[model samples]
Target: MTQENFNEGLLGFLDASPTPFHATQNMAGMFENAGFIKLYEEQRWELEPGKKYYLTRNDSSIIAFTYSGEKNYVMVGAHTDSPNLKVKPNPVIKEHGAVKFGVEPYGGLLLNTWFDRDFSLAGRVSYLDSNNIIKDALIDVKKPIAIIPSLAIHLDDKANQERSINAQSDILPILSTSDDFHFEQFLKDQLKISGVDEVKELYANDLNFYDVQNASFVGLNDDFIASARIDNLISCYVGILSICSIDESKPMLFIANDHEEVGSSSTSGAGGSFLENTLHRVFDDYEEFVQMIRSSIMISADNAHAIHPNYPSKHDANHAPHINKGSVIKINASQRYASNSKTVSRFMNIASSIGEPFQTFVTRSDMGCGSTIGPITATRLGIETLDIGVPTFAMHSIRELCGSKDAYSLYKIILSFNDS
Candidate 1:
């Protein structure tokens, strides 16, 4: 796909997916459209060579793969979850004449950017049906419903110089001013509007408030794309598109795991048994599974920190990556990232073969480095792994920025890697 089309698809994916559930749902749709047979973990599978299959866990994480007779596979990994504020179980709070939502921060987020933005809610909801059966449905309150208004600077003159955010009290989003607002009724109305009928009772919901602004191209020349959840979702989109566009007979797999931002310890996370269990299920024999894993490699695609012009000192001068340069290879001597000389050389060779420019990133010596699912996946499965991503700015913020050309560049390199 052309860079324009690739970025267009990325924008659509970002805007449609406000939460992990929605992201997984959209990815599943893409897989289905590409003729991938959906598999349920509970069902028996008949293995067929050169067939495409996919499955999901907890409706939040997804794994799609092409089944081939070859033992070795090319794999791409990304996370579906991003940092945001999630609604509490009992979210409704009426105080001082306005009803607000009780929200808690999820993952490491730029808390200040969340204030004074148009906000909406989207997530998975579970409820009892009219037939007395429990079912789950996804909901997206597309319009603006709530906002976290910042306190006026005039009221607190010190706000600009010194201000602290209290997660509990400072970030609650005002929903409505009327005392008649009921959270349960509001959910029921949304479900009905979403065409989910026969809702008997709302048992539970996992909802998050998101910025209502749509993802779009920024700058006069459209050199950048601005969107929420771009940190990892862009990688997820690249993986899915690359997998779908490749020759189906090629042995490849793509996984978008959930809960990476908050440490991937859950059942659907990279730290868990999801990928390993799936591989075992596919290979069946212990010997073949080990052989396949040993022969294969995984590319962990997460956003890399781009050097900010305002604070270039934050990055290592020699290893700093700039936006629009190309894809970045992230390395850490302490193994915070999984990239080693072997994997790094392999990736560099692939990019060079395709005539693609690439950059490297290493955190400053005085700064502590952050990590991705690369090390976790490498340790879990004993597979050769490398960490790479598009250089990004404002990572973990409500809205992040990345070069319009970077995503497509990485996508090309990933396709070439799989082909190699």
Candidate 2:
């Protein structure tokens, strides 16, 4: 696909996926539309060569693969989850003539960016049906329903210099001014609007508030794209497009797991047995599974921090990645990123063969480094892996930015990698 078309599709995916559940559902739909058969974990598997299959765990993590009877496979890994504010179980709070919702920060997000923005709720909700059967449904309150307004500067004249956010008291999102507001009734209303009409008890929900603004092109020449959850969702989008557009006859797989933002320890996360268990199921022979893993390579795609012109000192001058330069190869001496000499050479060769420029990132020696699912997956599966990403700015902010050309560039490299 053309770069323009690819970016348009990416924008759509970003706007549609406000939570991990929604991202997984949207990606599963893409695979299904490309003739991939959906598999359930509870079902017995009947292996068939030259067919494609996709499966989900916890409705928030997804894995899609093509079976070609090959011992080795090409793999891509990404995370569907991003940093946001999660709603608590007993979220309702009435104070000072306004009804607000208690929220907890989901990850290491920029708390300041979340203030004074229009917000909406989206996630998975479980409830009993009319027949008393438990069922889960996805919900997206598309419109702006809440906001966390910053305290006026007049009240705290030192706000610009001395301001600090108290996560408990400073970030409660105002839902409504009316004291009669009922959180459960409001959720039921949203469920009905989302087509879940069976009137029954609400068992539970895993909801997160997201920026209501849609993804859009920015910059004087529209060279940049801006949106919430761009840190890893952009990588997920690139992986989806790359895997779907490649030759499916090859033994290739693309997996987008949930809970990566929170250390990836959940059952459906990279630290869990989801990917390993799935591989074992696909290759029943233990020896063959080992062989496959040993011979295969995985590219873990996550967003890397680009050198900010205003804060250039934050990055190492020699290892700073620039916007639109290319996909970044993230490296860390502490193994925070999984990139190694062998994997780096393999990735660089693919990009070079495709005539695409690539960059490398290394944090300053005095600074600590953040991580992705790369090292975790590599350690878990004992697979050769590399960490790479599109150079990004304002990562983990409510609205992040990235060059419009970077995602398509990574997509091209991944296509070449799959063929190699």
Candidate 3:
């Protein structure tokens, strides 16, 4: 596909996937449309060679694989969740006649970017229906309905120089100022609008506030993509595009797990047994499984921080990645990432084969580096892993930026590996 089409597809995926549940559902929908069958863990899996199948766990994490006879697997992994403010269970907090929702940060976030922006709720909500059966419904306000207004410059003289954001007091998103701002009733009304049937009462929810702005091409020549959650969603989309284009059915897989932001600790997270348990089920003989895993390779696809022009000193002089340069291979001696010399060379071969450019990233020795599912999955499953990403700017912000060309380049890089 053309670079323009690649970016458009990426935008469409980002728009549909504000929360992990939604991301998994949207991916499952794509798989179904591509003529792949769905498998449920509770049911018997009649997996066969040359058939494509996808499955999910916790409604937030998903794994899709083509079950061909190839014993050695090729895997691409990415996280579905992003950094955002999550609505608490008992989320209401009213003050000064203004109604607000209590929210907690889900992961490391650039809180300053969240201020003075339009926000809306998007997640799955559970409630009982007329049949008294529990039903889970996905909801997105789909508009700029809520906001966390920043304190005006007049109120804080040093605002431009320095600021401290209080998670408890400063981050509650203001919903409305009406005296009749009832949270439960408002949710009930939204359910009706969402075509949810027999809404008895709003029972429980796992909602998060996200920017209402749609992703778009930015920069002087429209070379950049400006949008929310571009950090890892770019990789998730690239993995999807790459795996689906593989013409031969093989022991290759794609997994988008949730809760990677805080840590991949949950049932659906990479630290959990999702990948291992799936492999166990797919293979019957223990000896074969271990041998196959030894031969397998995992490409951990997460967004890497590009060298910011204004903060060039923060990056290692020799290892800073450039925007639009190509797919970035992240390396750290401390194992925050999983890329080793062997796996790095494996990735380099694909880039060379496709004539795609690439760069490397290593943080300054004094600074700590962030991580991806690479190490965790590699340790858990005893498989070799490589950490790779499309370079990004303003990562963990409410809106981030990346080269539009870089996304498609990463896609072709992964495609080269699959085709090889």
Q: What TM-score, over all chains together, does every model reach? A: 0.99, 0.99, 0.98
What lDDT tens digits, residue by residue, belong to model 2 across residues 313-349?
9999999999999999999999999999999999999
Which pairs of residues have clashing backbones in candidate 2?
none
Q: Once superposed on the true structure, which residue ranges of model 2 sit more than 4 Å away at CA? A: none
lDDT of 1 by residue, 1-420 (tens): 788888899999999999999999999999999999999988899979878999999999999999987877889999999999999999899999999999999999999999999999999899999899999999998999999999999898999899999999999999899999988889998998889978988898999999999999999899889999998999999999989988878889999999999999999999989999899999999999999999999999999999999999899999999989999999998999999998899899999999888999999988999999999999999999999999999999999999999999999998997767
What lDDT is obtained when candidate 1 is compared to the true structure?
0.94
Off by more than 4 A, model 1:
none
Regarding lDDT, does 1 or 2 come out ahead?
Answer: 1
lDDT of 3 by residue, 275-358 (tens): 898887788679888988998899999999899999999899899999989989999999999999999998898899879999
Angstrom error at residue 144, model 2: 0.4
